[model samples]
Target chain A: MGNRSKDLLQVEHSHPSSSRESSLLVGKNDSKPLQQKSYLQGNPITVPFPKSEVLGKVKDFIGVISEANRNLRLYAKDKPEEYDIEVLTGNESEYIKMDLMLGIADLHTPESLAAAEAAIAGCQSVINRNSTSSSLEFEGSSEEEEDEEEDDGGEDDDTRQSGSHVRHKDSELQQDDFLSALLRSHQKKKPSKIIELSVQSGSDCSIRSMAMATLRREGKRLSPLISPRPIEALRSALVPYQEEAHGLRYISTQAVRNRMKSVKSIQKITKAMKMVAASKLRQVQSKAENSRGIWQPFTALLGDIPSVDVKKTVLVTISSDKGLCGGINSTSVKISRAIHKLNSGPDKEAKYVILGEKAKVQLVRDSKKHIELSITELQKNPLNYTQVSVLADDILKNVQFDALRIVFNKFNSVVSFVPTMATILSPEIVEREAEAGGKLGALDSYEIEGGETKSEILQNLAEFQFSCVLFNAVLENACSEQGARMSAMDSSSRNAGEMLDRLTLTYNRTRQASITTELIEIISGASALEG
Target chain B: MSSSAAVPFWRAAGMTYITYSNICASLVRNCLKEPYKSEAIAREKVHYSISKWSDGKSEKPTIRSDVAED
Candidate 1:
């Protein structure tokens, strides 16, 4: 209490001389500057906060101020270093992708083709350079001379030809005669040719299932054409090229498979797009037709109302709850806003009954203090007459309005959509205008006398118009909703197809690289084998 | 099951004698422990006498009277 009184007395003393201003002194240990110091020295007490906590708060505030800047810097500083590494790696990968594609093309084109041509030339040159030595062995003149001598000796010996018919007992005598003749021929012939003659006669004669004849016929027909040397060389040269061709074929098959997948995906997308467009077009047309049927009777009845001054108007704006159908809801909202703006006067007033969420959101901002009475989850099912009439009765009973208008997307055709406003409460002025323009052809045709009375007829007309307008609103909304859905699905399918196409292109490029490498190795190997 | 009827006489006798002798030896070995050398030998003799007749031989051995009675 003493301290409080002392502090109050100091404040009172300092209040008289306001120029001095350092009055609330509690303790010298206080780090905070006095509030009176703010008045005296004009230096505010600035609290120094922890840098890390302050920076965190600043970052939070910056995120609210500009999300794009904060996100970009945060991603750069805090994200994995692999992102930059990936960027560099992606460049390298792209180079590899290009090289791979080019390699495949080169394998089919100048590089591999040149290599194949060179290999073929080398093979042909080898054959040409070897032709001299090869021809010497091929002509085999000395061998032929020996062969001729053998043939002459074989022709003179009837024993050699007739031994095939030798019976079991006489075969021994025939064999003795054959050996004596062979000896006589060997003595008569040239010494070098004698051996060949014996070999030829023995080979020409069948063994008659005797092992002795086979033994005598051995080592005949030994020439260069039948030699294993050339065959061995040809086989060794052929192996590498054949292996290369097989590798190329495998790579080409994979490339073709990848391309086929992309082609199939494109075909699927195109087919799906056509289906969606066709279905949406049909649905939109049908809904338009049904709505048209509803609107015709409504318009006719609207021509019967007697009111002219639209001092107070009730606008019922209908739009699709879902957006994606080009500009249907936007135009409906725009037309509703225009009507509201035109009716805002001292005497004139405009009220709104929103049918869809999209239109309600738009109109809610403009209408000050006049909130919309929105019925939630009412548009999913078909519109019932009882519900529609209840709405109509509520509007008619609670609100005193001169004009009632409906703003909705009117489907003129499959391609043509328009925002249309039709008056339901005041039809006489519209009818007068139609008459003035020489269009009084349909009013007298609908008039029935004395069965109910003119006033009763007018009341019935009002009820019918209300039903028609409500039905039209629901049908148009359904059509617009379906149209939006179809287009959205179509674009989604197209995007997926495009992604598949790009992946296939990448796959082809990689496959091409592998094929090119195989081709190079094959050419080098074949050349090595040939040399 | 009756393949023994087709087997040679010597082979069948040998197989039957080996099987019976193995079974009798294992049963006596499991019952007797080390350090009872004389008693173990007597037990083995008794087991062999009991099982000897089970062998399918041309001249079959008879079981000892004491074992048969037991």
Candidate 2:
């Protein structure tokens, strides 16, 4: 509290306009109706949520004045830190009541996002406005935050979870990032021009949304702005947020007789999805096609190990999560079963890590015992390295094996999709193979330009290579799946066209026979009447 | 400079890999020869209807179901 008060005085003295501007920005960004209404004197506070959130500016101005008063009083006191701790205790109690008032589970997400967004823009401007003092203040806050986090975290197990404390640290780090970025961005501006600070939170790509859906959940507290950030890097960090693939199980063949008009409409939707879907397949396919591309060397280095001394083997079968994709899943399942038969015996153990729902439904009936891990809804999104890498990590964690054999449909042109297997040796096996000197083949030098022990480098290389191989295998399988579906749908649509013609012919024939019968009856009746 | 780091940061957190690769794939997809791309897309120019799998079970002529058949 004392530090905040001190900082406020320093900022107000340095730049008079900033104190007003800080409150204005906060008010504008407050999507949450945090009025901080006067319920202070040990009384239960009612929910003061006015229906109109337009009162943000009014409430925020009042909040700033109160903040300024509190800070000023604390600055006057000898021990500001002790007074601030009391303020924290008071706020924490009120926040507990506020949590109860906000009934919705995800209410905090948006509120936090807004707070973080404002913090980013606000902190950046503060650093830009007064450079030297802000940096010092930043270090102080960071040190305090770290200390607070250490106090929060004593349990070793809970650290595995990127807990609430870590997120607080992340937000502080984010402020540091903004400070650095603004230092660079501000340098380009005219010296005399005042830097305008407007918070842009609505942009989904902005740090607001990204903060909530961070890769921290994966136990990797990576800085968002360490280097050039490709937005897709964090794509997997976001929950798949897609319709579950299992829902497709309920949808059967077209129930309505698809008229010419209906067929055209269906084609339009398919076309829109396909334009994107096909190109993705084509890109992955192109990479696979290339004989001497830059990625080719990487692919080859990490590519198929023809034979590994199979003691305990894991067959990771790649198949589509959704049904109606024809034989994309079936062929892979067939090969998976065959490998299981080949590798499984008295001494050797082979486990199945099925990667789709379609195969799981089939394999569960027969080889339920060998199945270690089954992941579905994977094909709901396109394949990416980070997602696949995470998946590889998960698979490795669950199953300890000598050889990791990946069975996926290798795309060979439009019609031919071969159910192929790519084997990646475990790190220990790789080290063993290196000692025996089988197929090191100048590949080791290319992949890991070594300074460390050869074995240590190989261990890291093996894990990384598994991710790459798995990533490629998934892409190849996806391309094959798309091609297989296109051909299957093409033939089925043709069959439907022919069936429509046949049905129409039958209808016409029945109509003609009925008309002929009616005409005969009419003629007989007329002849009888004349006689 | 040789990247001494064992795994790319994207491999861990902050989406270094998924975004980078998805972007790369999209870029490659865009670079395809124009004629072949347009031709195939045009071939799929027309194809709609609701209530799938309803036909295999429905014996009645679809002429009277919902929308007035033309």
Candidate 3:
């Protein structure tokens, strides 16, 4: 290939351009002979752009320019004058240049860049949250240790049970067991959960706020349960325990209080996350609803597509780029793994289309060979049907796939997001979807005109399928993300609040003990004087 | 391009000139007039005349509280 042709090809392959045809048209001017001395006078082979920085800053602008120029030369080979050189300035330009070099070097997937961006965004968003939600403390216990302790207690309670008076006794025992289990679990989980809650609250105040609201509700629920415990025995045991351990209880209580403050902060963050997710989910749901209207009629026109002899399959896996929301990415990853396991043969290799950066990373790590095409920045403009169509077209034309499968987290509601898989290319899937039935009332109302050809209908159907798959996947993934984030924040806030409560109690008790000891010394002194 | 960038500044200056008198008048009234006004001038003179050498209220309280507690 000519220098210009090579540059054009590189640009088409590497950069996120609006279109490739425009570059191709420009690349035809490659006959502008390499007569002019090179862009830089230095030998082409000498000192390939400096990677090191002097005093934490690039010492050579020439090196940076040369590196950019080299790639641009390759990219601009076909279309030398087409690229806007101004766009190659500042931080954005530097990063773009770096990415181009990385892409050429073939170090990582395109999703890796997106993942790094999402992570930075996530970190910034968290920091912003911490600053705002400073006041509210929703304290709770941690999940891991609490889970084990509760599981054991639940097992013990379940084994002993039935008969009126015995039932009453059993009920009493169970409630006590439950409370004791909760308290014990809280003691174990409180420290770590408190810290996590505080840090998250600091990072994301909205979640902390939500957690506070949950804690208030929990506190109200806990109030009724508090009285049934044998207070006298517990108090006596606690008091001696407090004294015997060289003020360890006092310190523990202080730790708990501080943790509680952290939890309250965290609750605010979680609550905010939930609200944000809820709004985003609603938007996604509407998009999905609209997409259904578009796709159902399109599919209906096709009548039926035979699913027999499914040879090669293309699977589009959708997940969120950033993970604070629990199990959203994991669930999608699981579904992908399941699909990989099901479609494992040399002839029937599964071509993977990863929608989100996080899912792409996971799938790439798991099945290195299967990821044919990966896309990121779905979260930036999730409802862009044009992008989806482009992606779908690339899959449909470039590769031979007998069928298409889409896996994503489905948004049932604010709290319930389930991992769902749909076979898009198969008639069986459509038939099942039609038979199993869904919320397609809006779609049924749209009327089509007479004598529309099958080809047009198929074209429309293909477009609709792409749009629907993209829309539904985005909605489900987003819903799952928000829900998971809310819960995580909620737990953190609760954990913090619990720590504060324990701390305040200890502080009070310490004060009381000091007062009592002082009184005793005064009384003893008085008695000796009297003697 | 240079001429185009400077055009807005000249327009802004003309607008600022039109509002200058009113702005100056408001500044004098708002900033200077208030301080000269007197409130209970006789009481202020009495406090100035009979100023006793005593600790500030905050300082007195701290002293009293500490002594009482002791």
Candidate 4:
């Protein structure tokens, strides 16, 4: 079995490899000799070359210089006692030249090289004074030699213990020097840090003045580089304060007054809006109650009919165009989306007929392809049967559908409403049921005149039903919108009142604090005069 | 009995009456002829009711009735 398996594997592998070898041989036969002959006859042959080689070399050169500069900077920072400025500057120049010869040195600009040298020089001098004061004996030791000596000493216990006492004293002095050098370098690197420290300390006026003078000098020198001066940055940051010492008190009072005025005005507007919405809610609620008679029975009838095999359905979503109606519009939109999701399949096509601007704006963002028609400005005035009839007629004439589903917010109470959906069967479905004498048995019993066919009568009935249902849905939605708006405005007014209370409390406390400070100043002045 | 009593009488009767009225009204309107028929059709085509609150100007609400006047 093992031999047979090996034979099968060999056959499978050999078939592709042998075919690949034959193809390679054919490929060579056609062009290999011609290419070699061209090369021999001194004719140029085209060959693809990668374009990134030059860029790659430039990047590598930059990387090497940056890495060397980083290492040298770290050495200068960590072990200032072992640093020799003159030797370091000389080695840096030589290393750079060697790297240039090796095709890796691209730091050719004078300014950058000068900057590197200046940074090294600055770092060297920072620790030079401290190192010279303490480590005069080890001053001439190279960095690598010192490291090697330390490493070798670590290997032998006798030598290590003998050197520990001297090393400890040296290290103590080195720590002080290193800390001072670090502070100096940090001050130079970020002048702002020193200025902030001086300002925060506040006890030493002489030091702050000196720091300011040095920052001014550095700012002048680095002006071409656009480095922000510490003094200038501080001045800009404190620009809201006046130059005069007493101006701060007057500015605080004026800012407080302005804030109080704006908050008061906002509170007034929200209070007025809340009152208006509350008054309007009553009328809208009554209208919604009256319209319940129109839609409730139709919905009941619709519920009795069994679900049909509908290919196309029209979804009519009712909402108000205005905002600040809480989540009424979003509720209708969510219901429509869920219904659309349920009806979505390969064979089912759902088209949208939106009634208000709010739902149109939302559905258009995501389901623009399904929106067949959108009717706006319906909420500018209160909805009535006449407007809805015209809307229904327009929808009926424009689109063909087997069923129509209406989505609207149903007013349950003044504070709450539910997003509801109701369906209306098309005339064709009613006629089919009548013919079959099955689901819509009650609809089949209705008598028609001699001139009108059963289907035409059913069509007229459906159109009338659609208008009535749309009118009811719009009324209910409008009522819900008003109720929601009233509650939302009430809550906003309450929140604004709370905010006003907090602001007034803050304003009064600030006033009292300023008053107390002035009184204390006067009392101190009086006591000093008496003394 | 209390739940049934809670429902208003007009609500129970109004739905059937309106549905029947609408069907009858459309059928009767369909039998009319000439200018009267055209006027009735136009009137039935668009309906407008007065809003409770006037939005500044007392102008009637704008209507987009493009039902072919035929």
Candidate 5:
């Protein structure tokens, strides 16, 4: 390729007529050329010529030529030989004029258009969004150029094509710098037309592309001398497709990064909740250690029974105040609903004494009429004998019933809990049972002490037993809540981790793909410029 | 009708056994250690903020220990 360029330069130096012949030979001579980088390492490699600086230099040169032509046009009409010189110089002027048009066309051609758009891409997101369409136009134009003045294929192309087209008219230097009017009249007509079109289409993109396409098509048609060498055409066609793939890659990298960030934050939250729940479970389980036997007195006096035939029954539900414990509140609510259904009838009446906001909200929706006394926030503070005693006294004063059942969740392990109910009988019911000689009637066999009346002693014991049973129930329910919450948060954190893994994989693959596309663009571009 | 031990002071003062047991439970709950003690004391400490709506807007609530004393 280097030798061929040297051969073309020699032809340009010899005579204007043989330059066409040499360009044809270079086009046809692509047989079995030596393919080595060593062949191209020499002085024949000229500076890449289609740069904006080079274009400016060429324009400055044209300005001088046009000035000289204007002066010579006054004297050339009288002499025939000088007229021929004028015509031939006119032809050289056309070559330079074509150079000026390609310079302008170089700025407007699809590749340069894409570069300009890319320069503004940071500010104009609207423009970047339409990159695919603009890329289609780039390939359609097949204007082989890399990033402005930096990469070589198009600059090298402009240099080689302009070198062949602008052969010095008379190599003998006789008609060379003559103030002859070479194509001065013809160049004026076309550029004036182009300048008019450029002005009209400056601000609007659609009009600008239309004008540029027209200029390129007409410049090739009108001045057949300004033609691109045929070999450059085959290589220029593939540049835009390579760029198209890169454009697609650049679009979605940001979206993938955003998804990765959100998933990571969610994982952080769930992990913190899991840790909090574990610590809470430990504390509550320790407090619940001595709460088991407080219900023994009520059991001994009442015996194991569900109070199936009681006329008036009160079901006391112990649930946690706060939520996010999985299935703890719901399981208790379901059991309470079943017991409520069993205890409802025309002659029999049942009431709910709900403890805790979670179960109260559920029960309110189902049986708002049956709820007698609902107390909440019992678990917000630590449970103790005094609080339970006060609360049990309040319940006893607020509602009148024959049988009272305290329902709560009993914690067995970290992963298991049982819905349990401890039943307590009213004093009147206890006294009747003693008269009827049931298992609880054995209480009469012992000597009771320290009360003005026997019935008052029974009431004292009942109230004390109620407070103890309530304290135990509240502690057990708290332990269960903490255990359920620990497991729930643990699973949430695990699911977040899984989602993050999938997103990170996608993020890595996309980043790698974008990098490879850029490398392919640079290497393919370098080879195309070589061609 | 029964052999019995001597009555406690609250019962001798004509208070019911229910009131006596509650007083004992309260005293025991107040003697707990650290975190449990603080919460239990706070639970038993009741303060009423009494407010009166005269003509239009209600007056600022005033802390009243008299209600719990009664």
Candidate 6:
């Protein structure tokens, strides 16, 4: 194997392109001519002849020589430009000299072959020695020390087996000594001091042997048999243990501690928010209560009039702009959608004038077809009469409706709110009702100036009533938003507190387990030393 | 408790009442068939402001040429 690989390496170094060509020419019948052509170019040999073939053919001496001589003479005479006789003779002489130097004649003899084999073996041994020393130098000294220790332990085991032979002989000798001592003691039974001294020495030797055995056992226990390499062991000792389940690794103690800290801070923030919302709710609730009284007379005036003939209805959905108010905005949106659904028909078309972005975002998704106008940022500050009036003006100018239904979350309690709807008659509706003279009987009771027409009074009353109802709805929705936010923040703070407790318990348990493991290791080490 | 503070309180209340009466009067005037109803509504439309477009151009021209262009 070595010789073949070496020959291939030499071929590769000498004729890399020829080696590729030869590999391509392999197993083809035309390979012989290709090989000869490549050999004629610069290579000295095309194919190496086997020793057996060369030796076997050598016996056909004169016939083969005369045939080769005649062919060479003919070739030289016919093509003197291709072959030179003097150069051929010089190459022949060099070849004969090389063959003689290599002992080609004595190659068939056993003694010369043995000598050649011994020379080759010596060279191979030298190469092997050099390769092993180079490899050992590449591997560092720490590995060498480990190997040496392993060798020493193996040798010790072997010596222990051999030492058993010597131990057997020593035991026989000790037995003989014991028999002699017994006989001597029996002969001199009054020598108690010497016997006591011998017994004490025996006990001391037994105790020392027991201590040595325990020390060896502890050493073996400390250095486990399939131990990791030193660097790997150090890394494993430093890294914290991680438990993986269902492809999810458990968070480390420090990560859990950080989460707990963030949750604690969040809990504090939510608690403060809850307090602020509670204080703001009181002021908003009172304003909402007063606004209801302010709009009561107008509502009473409109309530007496029956609704006009069915036409387009405008839905005014009121919700706060801000979120984290527990589902107050969603409840208003849902109630508006329910109203829109209930009032939908072939003759009656529902249009929406959404207030606040929360309801707009939701309504625009599914009810964009019904939405006529969306007003936002009105809830940034407390709702005021002027803002609502501007909004009502915008609605009145842009949209036409028979009835305007205001959908809003009504403030019920600090922890609860309900979505409510209130309807205001449009100017046309009030005109139609006044013309009917059915519900306008109540209006006739009020004395008016001779210049003031009843229709003008009703129109102004309708517009004013529209703005008043919208203003009341806005205030009520604002109060409800604060109350809902207070309750939401209260619950969020409670949940955060619970999560913090859980995380703290987990952190404490992990720390306690680590401490206990360290204590166990120390105690075991102390007991091992004592043993 | 003091007459000066009471004066300001009455002034604020009177101001509120005046604003309210003005809004009601304007609403009543804007109603159809009242004085200057069409012109008042046209003026309201011209002055109406939209959040999206602020050029203050009315949707339609109020004035037109009586003579036909050649």
Best-fitting candidate, measured by lDDT?
A: 5
- Candidate 5 lDDT tens digits, A259-310: 8899889889888988988998888798787777767756776574675357
Best by TM-score: 5
lDDT by residue (tens digit), candidate 2, A376-424: 5554334444456666665665678899899998888778898888787
Q: What residue runs in model 3 are displaced by over 4 Å at the alpha carbon?
A: A1-261, A302-309, A390-399, A426-460, A522-531, B1-70
lDDT of 1 by residue, A1-531 (tens): 133224323533533322111111111102112211222243234333233232233225333433433344468578756434325644454211111111111111122223333344344322322223321211222355446534544453354335323222222222333333333333332233223223233322222212212211221112222223433444456668867876765555455566667667775865576576567557555655765676675555345332335677877778766555566778888988887777668988777766666776665565623433443334433443333444454445445556777777766554456677767764344444446543334554565654454444454456457656766665665565555545555666677677767767777687778778778989999999999
Runs in model 5 deviating more than 4 A are: A1-247, A450-452, B1-19, B26-70
lDDT tens string, model 6, A1-531? 133223323432443222222321121211223222332453344243223322223224323433544565578689875554224543353211110111211112222223333333332221222223222211112355436534533443343334322222222223222222322222221112212122223222233223222322222333343233332332343333321231233334878878998999999999999998889888888889999887789866767332344578888999877888899999999989988887779888888887777887887778776777767667544555655675676677678788888999888888778788888776566666656777654655778654545665566577778888888888898899889999899999999999998998999998887777778989999999999
Residue B58 CA error for candidate 6 (Å)?
A: 19
Q: Could you give the candidate ranking by TM-score, starting with the highest?
A: 5, 4, 6, 2, 3, 1
User: How far out, in Å, is residue A271 in model 5?
Assistant: 2.1
Residue pairs in clash, model 1: none
Worst 10 residues of 6 chain A by lDDT: A96-105
Candidate 3 residue lDDT tens string, A49-70: 3321221221232234335545
Pitting candidate 2 against candidate 4, the one with the higher DockQ is 4
- Interface RMSD against the true structure, candidate 2: 13.7
Q: State in Å the error of residue A332, model 3.
A: 1.8
lDDT score at residue B54, model 5, on the 0-100 scale:
34
Alpha-carbon shift of residue A327 in model 2 (angstroms): 1.7
Spell out the clash pairs found in candidate 4.
A386-B47
Total clashing pairs for each candidate: 0, 16, 56, 1, 4, 0
TM-score of 5: 0.53
What is the lDDT, from 0 to 100, of the residue A337 in candidate 6? Answer: 93
lDDT of 6 at A385: 63
Clashing pairs in 6: none
lDDT of each: 0.46, 0.50, 0.46, 0.56, 0.58, 0.55
Where does candidate 2 chain A have its weakest 10-residue lDDT segment?
A: A96-105
